[model samples]
Target: MNRRISVAIDGPAGAGKSSISKVVAKQLGYLYIDTGAMYRGITWALLDQEIEISDTAAVKAALDHIELQLVPVEDGLRVLVNNRDVSKEIRTQYVTSHVSQVAAQKAVRTKLVEMQRSMASVGGVILDGRDIGSVVLPDAELKVYLTASVETRGHRRWLELKDKEDITLEEVCRTVADRDTMDMERKESPLICVDDAVVVETDHLSIEETVQKLTELIRNAEKGERHG
Candidate 1:
């Protein structure tokens, strides 16, 4: 029998980590945990209450009212906060611009990391986030750092948001660049690719191509673990 192992996929925003990881988990019949969505959930809740995120004390207090859950559906995962589904709401421009600030909070990271750790304590789980390989799942059987050029990522993000937002491509690219700097420079669980992580650059690859590549890597990882 093949072993069921934890897989950690880490990368910067708009790098397709969440989308690719979701598909990979489905193909492998593993549990898919979207750590980024959890942080987004917190960010959304804070905004809903009109709480000032800069006030660390208020943010810490707001955590008590937030209850996040990731429910699986035929289409994909549905993110819930306090029993309210905010899957689409959390992906809004407001949350996207502010999630980094909320995520950087020590209190937010502490609470969400605990939840993430509990969800992945079992094997056959795949998690995608900034610090999954570096902090959340250091002992994961396979660690993949999926990335692409900032321009590519920005273009992709712009494509996703063009219909919903009134932003220009240039503005989207600048936002992506700024997010990269903030994510890399943040003090709490900043985005990083560990030495053991396999870096996959998707500058020219289609989604299908990337998924196939990761699926093959996962199969090889399982075999290597069996022998080792």
Candidate 2:
């Protein structure tokens, strides 16, 4: 029997990390760990409890009591905080606006990164997030820095949000740019493509095409690991 391996996909916002990772995981029979949703869950909890994100002490205190669970659903993943399902709540505009800063918080990252590491320790897991390959799972069997042009990512994000929000394309593009800066400049575990990670650009590739490409990389990695 072949040993299951861990795959880490890191990328910027609007880069289709979540969607691509989901398909790849399903195809490979691996557990997909939605690290971004975990961060969003924390963000939602802080806002729900009225805890100021800038207040580091308060944020650390809240972490002690907060509990998060990621349950897989037919359509997508469901996030639960303290036993309460906030799957839809975490995707709201309010949470979307504040998630970057919340994710940047050292205390928040520390707590969540530990959980993410534990979850991936068993292998056969595919995790996509800003820092999965760089920080959470540096030793993942396959590390992919999936990305695309800023304009492309912005347009994709805008399309995803158009039906849910009354935001314009330009505004969505600006938001994606702003998020890129935050994710790259943040003090804690900033988004970066590790030296060993394979960079996969999706500027012109369809979701199916991108998935096919990554799936091939993963299979090759598995073969190499087995023979090595």
Candidate 3:
């Protein structure tokens, strides 16, 4: 690699950003970050401490003590919350359900965004989250907004949750669309595509193709910066 560049990937649920971001990071020898998981880890912390999701004051206090760490691993990232390994715990359905709520808090967002910025200051990171390009790291070398039709994204989520639970495509579509609307309509920081961000519609794309597209974007960005 000529130079390490930070990549920001923003997308709604089941848009294939996480998997493709990981693969792209690995191919570029960069650190991969799932910002969604950071929120999930925070939710796990709050739940483990029995903090009410709606109690903003207590939630902020609890967030004061919890530490979410993203450690580099060979294949994927290892997520740690407050010294304990809550990687698997954060992925539970409970955490998934509450993560958006926890993340919507301004105080919580402030803390996590600070942590994310500290982690990505060194570059060579591919971060996937709702606000990475829009709010988290606006100056990232390359920003990508991944998207797909609600029906397509829903079907993908259905397949992913097929073995885990009995979720139908119709239910998946409704949930996915609802989540998308919530993420975009939230008052804290609506998920929006920022200037200079590349929009990639992943409705009919493979993970490999998506990764290649993102990697090419980063390469071109780096090349332009060097020449300019």
Candidate 4:
């Protein structure tokens, strides 16, 4: 039997990291881990417990009691906190606005990285997030830095929200810039591209196109995989 492998896909918001990662994982028969959602789940826990984000010690303590889990489903993945369904809850406007602060916490990143590594130990996984390629899985068989123009990303988010919520294109554009600022300025694990990382520009590509390119990258890498 062939050994499993790890793939890391990193990108800014609305560049289709979540959507592309899911489709790519399904095609490759690999488990997909959304590190962003994991951070959001922890943010949800902080809000539920009325813990303040500024207090680092308090935030770290709160995380000890909250357990985050992911279960694959027909629609996508289901997120659970303490084994309770919170997939939809974490995507709310509230969580969307606050997740960055929660994720910015250094202690929080340490804990989450530990969990992500434990899950990726056996491979057969594709992890997507801002820092996955640079920090979480630097040794992944394949690393992708997926991105699109700020305007394009905003438009995509606008359409999604217009269909399901009340977010405006202008608002999303601002959110995109804000996230980029915070991520780039962050002290711990700022999102950066290392040497030899493949960058995918998705401004004009279809979702299928993005997945197809990534799939080929993996197939090529698997040829060079090491086995005992």
User: Which candidate number would show the highest lDDT if scored against the true structure?
Assistant: 1
Give the higher-TM-score candidate: 2 or 3. Answer: 2
In angstroms, the error of model 2 at 153 is 1.3
lDDT of 2 at 200: 91
The numbered model that scores best in TM-score is 1
lDDT by residue for model 4 (72-183), tens: 8976799999998999899776787788878888989999999999988888999999898888998888888899989999888788777777778898899888888788
Candidate 2 C-alpha RMSD relative to the actual structure: 2.0
> Where in model 4 is the C-alpha error above 4 Å?
1-3, 225-228
Better of 1 and 3 by lDDT: 1
Error of 3 at 122 (Å): 0.7
| Cα TM-score of candidate 2 | 0.95
Q: Better model by lDDT, 1 or 4? A: 1
Model 1 residue runs over 4 Å out of place are 225-228
Cα lDDT computed for each candidate against the true fold = 0.92, 0.90, 0.83, 0.86
Candidate 1's displacement at residue 126, Å, is 0.6
In candidate 2, where is summed lDDT lowest over 10 consecutive residues? 219-228
Worst 10 residues of 1 by lDDT: 219-228
What tens-digit string does per-residue lDDT give for candidate 1 at 106-223? 9999999999999999899999999999999999999999999999999999999999989999988988888899899999999999999999999999999999999988888887
The TM-scores of all predictions, comma-separated, are: 0.97, 0.95, 0.92, 0.94
Ten contiguous residues with the weakest lDDT in model 4: 219-228
